[model samples]
Target: MIAAVRVRGRTGVKKGIQDTMSMLKLTRINHLVLLHEDPTYKGMLVKAKDYITWGEIDEETITQIITKRGKLSGNVNVTEEYIKENTDFSSIEELAKAVVAGEATVEDAGIKPVFRLHPPRKGYEATKQSFKEGGSLGNRGNINELVAKMI
Candidate 1:
């Protein structure tokens, strides 16, 4: 799965990018969403690259995110028992490992897919330029560090 966070605010955003961001379920800055890596989602990401940062998420980081921010229907915090009761996996670690291995999905386990994150502790490098230009926007390759800061 790919992890993406909205890095920029809504002011002055183009309507197309705003629509794409909305489709990605990122309606606010610092909001995060996990997406399956596919051409369709990739196209959307490309369209909103200037307002978000995305990258492949590692298993360890996925586990951390699930353990720390995974939620369920009715806004319940995800717990080991909850996972065990609702899915084949007995624990969050198992679920996360399975997701990373492409054997399971959050939907299959009935967990909420969106994660609302805090702004990164130190803020972003730059939001107006692409990552290639030393900004935090665009594909980050590995977003564990950035996700950690927000978490």
Candidate 2:
């Protein structure tokens, strides 16, 4: 799965970009969404590249995010028991693996689709520039480090 994090706020953003970010479910800074790496999602990522950072995520990082930040309805934390009771997975690790493999989704695992992450521990770099330019925006290649800091 591809992980996308909104790094910038909505101030002075174009309405069309805001709408695209909304469609991606990245409505706030530090919010995260896992999406399939398909053409449609890729297009949306490109469209909102100026305000968000995205990259391929691994199973280990995904598991950590789910364990630490994944939430259920009514603000409950996700646990192995919850996964067993509400979904086919026996553990969060398994669910994360399934998600990374495109065999399952956060919703299918009974977790909220959006992950409300803490801002990175040390804060972001230049939010107005791309990752290639040593800033926090645009595709990040491997997003594990950034996600780790936030988690």
Candidate 3:
């Protein structure tokens, strides 16, 4: 059920990239699960930073977003037991592969589950106008204005 989630928040662990975390609760996924042939992975509650404390899902999602092979993937496992057991695997891909190879259980993927994330359904980005501000900055006043103008 590999579905891309629209990330939310901008204050989590940072790597070379993953600049910002998702900040809104806006997610529109029209599709359900894709091919459920694979085992379903769950999520573990990590800390949250930027907003309140620290520890968020941004890092995991960003890592998984990479499509190129060899690139580390996001952690899809979310079992407390697994996390309690192993505290290694610097990358999500390593954890994922571990799960595939039966070395680790789905719960032991290290990364949180995927369902909690916003799915990638390609929805229009919200603008200031939507928030009662101006449009975009391209003559519309703000980015939204420019978008509406272009449309």
* Clash pairs (backbone) in predicted model 1: none
Ranking by lDDT: 2, 1, 3
Candidate 3, poorest ten consecutive residues by summed lDDT:
44-53
- List lDDT for all candidates, in order: 0.90, 0.93, 0.27
* Sort by TM-score, top down from the best: 2, 1, 3
lDDT of 3 at 11: 39
Tell me the lDDT of model 3 at 54. Answer: 12
Candidate 2 residues 1-151, lDDT tens each? 8999999998999999999999999999999999999999999999999999999999999999999999999999988888888798888999988999999999987789999999899888888789999899999899999999999
Write down the worst ten-residue block by lDDT for model 1: 110-119
Candidate 3's C-alpha runs over 4 A off are: 1-86, 109-111, 123-151
TM-score of 2: 0.97
What is candidate 3's lDDT per residue for 4-24, written digit by digit as tens? 222233334453223221221
Highest TM-score against the true fold, candidate: 2
Whole-model lDDT for model 1 versus the true structure?
A: 0.90
Q: For each predicted model, how many residue pairs clash, with residues at least 3 apart or on different chains? A: 0, 0, 24
